[model samples]
Target: MGSTIFTPFSQKELIPKEEKLEIYRRERKLCIGIPKEISIDENRLCLTPDAVQVLVNAGHRVIMERGAGEGSFFTDLQYSEAGAEILENRKDVFAQSLIIKINPPTLEEIEWLQPNAYLISALQINLCSKEYFKKLSDKKINAIAFEYIMDEYKQFSLVRLIGEIAGTISILYASEILAQTNGQMLGGITGVRPTEVVVLGAGIIGEYATKAAIGLGASVKVFDNSIFKLRRLHTIVDNRVPTSIIDPKELKKSLRRADVVIGALPRINQLPIITEDMVSTMKKSSVIIDLTVDSGKCVETSELTTLSNPTVIKNGIVHCGIPNLTSKMSRTTTKAISNFFLSYLLEIDQEGGFENQLVKCQEMKQSLYMYKGRLTKCTIADKFGMQYHDINLLIF
Candidate 1:
């Protein structure tokens, strides 16, 4: 008899059934770290008891560092009732959990992280120290940064919603500053209105600033490099608000007319786009609010401003480049931030677990490090010029 020939089933068909069964057997735990200091803002609450209820119902254990939600007016007792275990020290939370932190983790906090722990936070990895990045790699931890994720629209996914809120609030910030200046009331003035508002970049922040300016009754003109964005803004605002694509000649004219200019430009290679010459063209008493100061100032003459000294006159314009504008409105900022974290948590929970779903999530795909103590994220490997192992091969 001739040797029997047989065909084998493909590996892909046999894989998912085992993977699903494995995921079903594992339990995922999440720990949230929030700051204390409710006296700063009362309207904000991080990881509400309601969100805890959802996690608990999903068969996950939720832990909160003692007073984590105190800054947001959430009590330890409230979280306990919602089925969360409260730990007294922040260190314990990091040691035992998949951590969710609002701010970048401190060096001490980073040291406490368990090996292979998943850390979700607004970690400015590009700006962080090489030592810190090395520690992250050494710990074999997966750091998922909220700022890097893109949404369905392909804009900064996690930040788009929060950016809108921040952008809208930024106008209120400018209004408060405007009220103190010599400018006339935003909307009530008729002849030679008090404020001539110039919004830079025409992104979410610029759009909201335009809306807020219109509501405040200010003469608003928006500027951007993208003619498409400018055209879109003109349509969105029904041409009631004026927008201009930046040209050197037109920029000089616009700056000369602007009394208050909001800089909403995003960061670009740590360089300032609004040159000093452009700044000098503005009115002597004009206010320049640089919202992009977080990435570094957009205005060439701009410097970092704190809540205490939020404005400084430079080259004939008042420059307001405060780093933490959202922090100024902690109540709303905290709630918005908490909601963002909730969305991420729900995504992980719904996908069965972080480890399993991470492969499927485009954002997590970029953020992942080691699966079973092997490197991932090519950027990290390339930056360090180190050898990397494929996570799929290790996991499978």
Candidate 2:
């Protein structure tokens, strides 16, 4: 009774005032670095001159390795005009807090990173190993893979753009190969049979390849294991192209007569659609562009080749398995990639900073494959036999 009498009115019984937290918006000044790519046949640049200008205008420091953008036809004067400091020594560029590039850093490049630095580049998962993760972990670096970067719609924006470029280039390269083999054009000619183009996989690359092939007046047939993707491709191509399930008999029959065979199959599957025996049946001098070769060959006889020596004759078929076809059109690809990255960097400024943005943006969080050197992507971790940590747990 004495305690009850001494107790004041409980705050829970009364209407309590709402406690408001103060929100501070401070400009995040980041030292962003662009390193020259030394990987085999990588020509794409992460940012363009215009992108550098925008970042510089936002009060962020931009450091570029001398000649970093030369592969994409961007001059040092252009980047300098956009307010970037050009450093001749690569180690100086790598000293920046944020590193961006096209290919995943080589082990030597990773050694150049400072502790807690952020790395943005392609993951190249098939080329990655446990040692890669261990190296990044040892250095306590954060890594983001462009392939995992997503948009508001949960679609892979970078992958789709690159796929479109690859698809268009694939058909064009095939046409060149066809001309090299026999002095024949890819499309229909009066009284001449149109080039028979058989495309495997009806995904993004296959869709664009079909469009390009059909536009050039080639007889195009697309095959996919997924009826949904095949149907989707049919609608995307205005219902004109022939679409079919990947029946072995029909596929082999097509292969025997096809002037160009495009292997645009998705990388999820490790098995090849066209085996050695099927490839051998193809017409001599036929061109096979296996765009999916990087992940795993879509044609059994196709081997990974560098841009310098991109084609090999296997069973009389010219197999071109260049992993990065987009690099052939480096300028256009660089512009597209720069646009994506500019928006991303601007968002970081608007959202306060990377850590805060990761907390607020689901898309940003999803794109982060590694945080503070810990493996955060389950698929990559599992594939490389490394321990996986939930990014959310590590972030907070």
Candidate 3:
């Protein structure tokens, strides 16, 4: 009875006490690595020279593989000038604790990673194998995917930015190819008919493509299976453009007169709505830009057109299905990506690095597909037939 009555809590209940504070651990100098992209389709760098400068100035160590920035016109000297150590050994760059890239690391590159290393890159899960993920788990890596990275509004920050670029460029490239092929302009002239632009899908890529076509004075007609998205796109453009559901007959009829067809459909169904027969119905030399070719072909006849041979002719229609459309504007895309990453790195720095940041940031947690060698993304796990672990369970 005496022991039960002499408790510290019983005494504290009657006594005034100071509040306890959460003291964060000491901040550590982050060592980040940038490896040169070996993928032919990926020509954009994750961080630019300016971004490296900011990180270096903040007492962080930056290691860059030699020739890492050449694709974006950022020379090794530029990165060196920004205080990054230029490492000729690719393996050495990958040895750092944190690695960033435009593309997901190749299976070989994953083997180069050290145990418990942190990775930030595009997670093109479509291109990855079960073996690739197993290697990551074996190394006990922490991986974040750019596609899952969210902003304050819960929208994908990096993906939307790249989608915006892709949308605008689709119209621009179409106009250029149209002008060169048939000497027809995108806009209407006093004596000439208005250029008819047909756009598929009403998502981010399609929305901005419609806006761009309208801005260039082209007559834009948008089609989508979703009435809501179509209606939203109509309102987004001030109800100035005509909208329709993706009816085969109506779409085929419109294709006959379309001067440019922008294919912005994603691979939700994995089947092309616009068939080869429908593509054949379009006007000869009409430009078709399949922005979602990387996901899957929206146009049945669209082919993989590389920079060397930028356009392919199928059924007498000019088709451009370059998957890495944003890479065409490499410098601009790199800078935008770098700006987003700069703030992300700085926040992690202030939070005493990845471990503490993992506990605090919801976005960071959401972006991670792998946490300390455990699979956290159900979508990826399901696709690859792998065991899934909850990030909440693993992080703590």
Identify the leading candidate in terms of lDDT.
Answer: 3
- Which of candidates 1 and 2 reaches a greater lDDT? 2
TM-score of 3: 0.89
On residues 84-160, what C-alpha lDDT tens digit does candidate 2 reach at each position? 99999998899888998888888888899999999999887766778888999999998999889988899998889
Superposed on all Cα atoms, the candidates' RMSDs to the truth, in angstroms, are 5.7, 3.4, 3.6
- Each prediction's Cα lDDT score? 0.69, 0.87, 0.88
Best by TM-score: 2
Candidate 3 contains a number of clashing pairs equal to 0
The segments of candidate 2 whose C-alpha lies over 4 angstroms from its true place after superposition are 1-19, 22-27
lDDT of 2 at 28: 56
Which pairs clash inside model 1?
Answer: 44-72, 151-157, 184-194
Model 3 misplaced stretches (Cα beyond 4 Å): 1-18
Name the candidate, 1 or 3, with the larger lDDT value: 3
Q: Which residue pairs clash in candidate 2? A: none
Give the per-residue lDDT of model 3 (tens digit) for 1-396: 355455556655978879999888966799999999888756799898989999999999999999999989999999999999999999999999999998888889999999999999987664577998999999999999988898768889888888888899899989989989998899877878899999999988899999888888889999999999998987888756888998998999999999999998876337887899988878898999988776667888887777657898888999998877788888998998999899988988988889898888787789999988999999888877899998888766
Identify the superior model by TM-score, candidate 1 or candidate 3: 3
Clashes of each: 3, 0, 0
- Residue 190 in candidate 1 has what lDDT? 61
Worst 10 residues of 2 by lDDT: 1-10
The runs of at least 3 residues in candidate 1 whose Cα sits more than 4 Å from the true structure, single-residue gaps closed, are 1-46, 125-127, 152-155, 192-194, 367-396
